[model samples]
Target: MEEERGPIECRVRVPATTTNFGPGFDAFGAALRLYNWTTLRVGNGGSAESLPPMVQEAAEAFGKAVGEPIPSFECAISGEVPCARGLGSSATVRVGVLVGLNELRGRPLSRGRLVALASALEGHPDNVAAAVLGGFTISTDDGQTRVALGSQLEFVAFIPDMEMETEWARSVVAQTVSLQDAVWNLQRASRIAAAICLRRYEELSGLFEDRWHEPARVKRIAAWEEMRRTAYGAGAIGFYLSGAGSTLMALAVGRGGEVATALTRVAAKRGLKGICRRIQAENRGAKAWLRRPSRRLA
Candidate 1:
């Protein structure tokens, strides 16, 4: 055991994701470059007696789900994804935990299996699908099938000052929406998917029009209209609420800075608090790289 005093460490790159694009509701998901890096160190091979209690609990929660014993080690996590926003913070964390442990275990979990488990933990497929697959993925409620997300589009997600929790926000949706609104969303969702496939950038702005959820969400969030105008006027192919509220994605065919700057000013003027940054979607998902352990930590 003294020969294994040190731990095995690894790094995972988990990208930020955009879900519920326009009217896709629970189906569509896109992966982005904005990511969280999770690094973990596992204790050397020892009996089940080697692990600590908190580490044991986390490992049990994450390990049994993967059909394995709880990892025998301690973990440290740090990164950019924020919690409680529409930006999928929970997905990032869960994926990070799974990836960190899997790496230490000689990659016992395959990529596809990891995605399904991540989706199960997240309670939704959108965010985890995008994070794991690194592109667009369509997942069902059970999260068994993770189809490759087939979109290579460039866009920016607008994050607003205020954060909206999905639970609280979702509770407000009426049990029955009008038929006209539902029809509008169905048509738009179809068109948006088609536009993405054909690479019809110009058609994007019109296709992003969602009559189902955004209209209602926008009414409550003060930052909606101004951010929309700023993105629209800046020649964004389209813009929409990223997930539920706060983050709004603007399409910039080639005008990345233009959209970021314009949205920044608009959000500031409204007396809202938030940050605006440019991000591009990665057709690929979670990735790991092996490097020499840092001397400082060593």
Candidate 2:
């Protein structure tokens, strides 16, 4: 945590993100208040044996992107964001590593370049872009990412006991969607951006319905239909699968606690052990800073 400039050290904190946002699949994303933290200490390239999988993957990607051998750095990774639940835990690691290394290397890569590298590493830009840029984001495959600043909103996150890997969840979705379904999502995605930016919470209920991914993937989560109904019955403005899914997000203006309580109760009654958390949107994105040691007294 020291701020004095001395031996090279960098710390990066990246937020967890929820992407797709119902009909906005692979396009819309918002950064949540939850975050993951990673720290890097520069030295000779260290052993890769013990590094976390995401960290390892990040390092490899960074080396390739920068056209340099990975430096020896001891890394300590920790965070509150849950993994394998579509919360961008992997993005946190990938982004943190790239950002941390960029700092240690005197930041040769521009932010845009870094983002492209991260997106390429992640196989898409949705979650990584939001985690890197913060706030609400819409990113395309062409390396263009946009952020829309707006009033913050609350979310009641129902984290189930089970884990659904993103790859598996994605595999269940159909590769080709109907033109009508595509049109259905296009209209709603545009409006969703306005609704979120304008704080029109009421407009979200209808806009949050999706025909592309949810119907196919919701079956993977235990009692998802029942939970959706329960959330609506409990006064949620709208709800959607958080990413690919074992975690559900219920949007609310002032009823976060009530919504969370209701979801937790329903989960318990259904013999599914899980907890609910009420979190807010984070406007700022990932942050990286050097933590140099304090100079000794002369």
Candidate 3:
């Protein structure tokens, strides 16, 4: 009889995501170069209670989706994505663990199925879709669509020192909106999606305006108008909130560094105290691979 393999390891790399994209609330998202990695090793007898809440939830969902009992495995996560800053840090972790678990079990779930699972856990599909598929994604309850962006585009992320919980942010939004406001958002969102899909970057200007979420969330961010003016003054084509709040993103072309510096200075001057990073959209999404096998010692 062949000797049984012992304790195989799998590693998954999932990119961070920025969703909402102004008027496209819960609809648009794009994967960024920032990443979170999760490594899973089987036969370690890891307990679900010990894992972070998000990881545990992901593990449970994975088991139920695949119709199998989750195996005993240790999980380790490391990455640059900051938590609760409107960047899809939670999605990255959830995707990482789910993909890592799937890889170790020989990938029983397809990428589409994985996206569906992650979206269900996240309570929204935008961030999870982009994090899983890469590129620009438009997500809805029915399905997700992706568009590849060019190298010329750059995203200047203004990450604040403070953190805003997604749940709290959602609580602040009005339960209902005016018909005019709803129509305004719909018009802009449709145009923005078309602009991105067609690569008409110039047309993206002024399309980021929204009457849905930003109007309410902007009040919570200190010096929002001044920072937005600074970003535009520095050659940003479009500016808006990344996800919920606390991290504002500027869409720029060749002037990313100028925009980043301007946003940083303005934020500090206004007492917000934050940093700006110039990042590119990641075309490739989450990836998984097995580590070299190691034998258990007797």
User: What lDDT does the true structure give each of the candidates?
Assistant: 0.70, 0.81, 0.88
Give the per-residue lDDT digits (tens) of candidate 1, residues 1-298: 0126455566778888888877877777887878887665555434445543433444565678666565444445567876666777777777876776776666877877777777766677888888887766666775533344333356676676577888876776566778998898888887777666566656767667777777777776777777887887987878888887668888777787888889888877887677887877777777776443533232
Best of the candidates, lDDT: 3
**How well does model 2 score by local distance difference test?**
0.81
Please write out the lDDT profile of model 2 over residues 1-298, one tens digit for every residue. Answer: 1224435678899999988889888888888889999888764235787687778887787778778877566788788999888788888889899888888877778777777888888888989888888888888877644555544368789888788888888888888999999999899988988777676767887678899989988887777888888888888887899888778988887677788888888888888777789888887888998866343211
Higher-ranked by TM-score: 1 or 3: 3
For residue 73, give model 1's deviation from the true position in Å.
1.9
**Which structure is stronger by TM-score: 2 or 3?**
3
Best by TM-score: 3
Candidate 2 least-lDDT 10 residues: 1-10
Instruction: Determine the backbone clash count of candidate 3.
Output: 0
Q: Model 2, stretches more than 4 Å misplaced? A: 1-6, 148-152, 293-298
> Judged by TM-score relative to the true structure, which candidate is superior, 1 or 2?
2
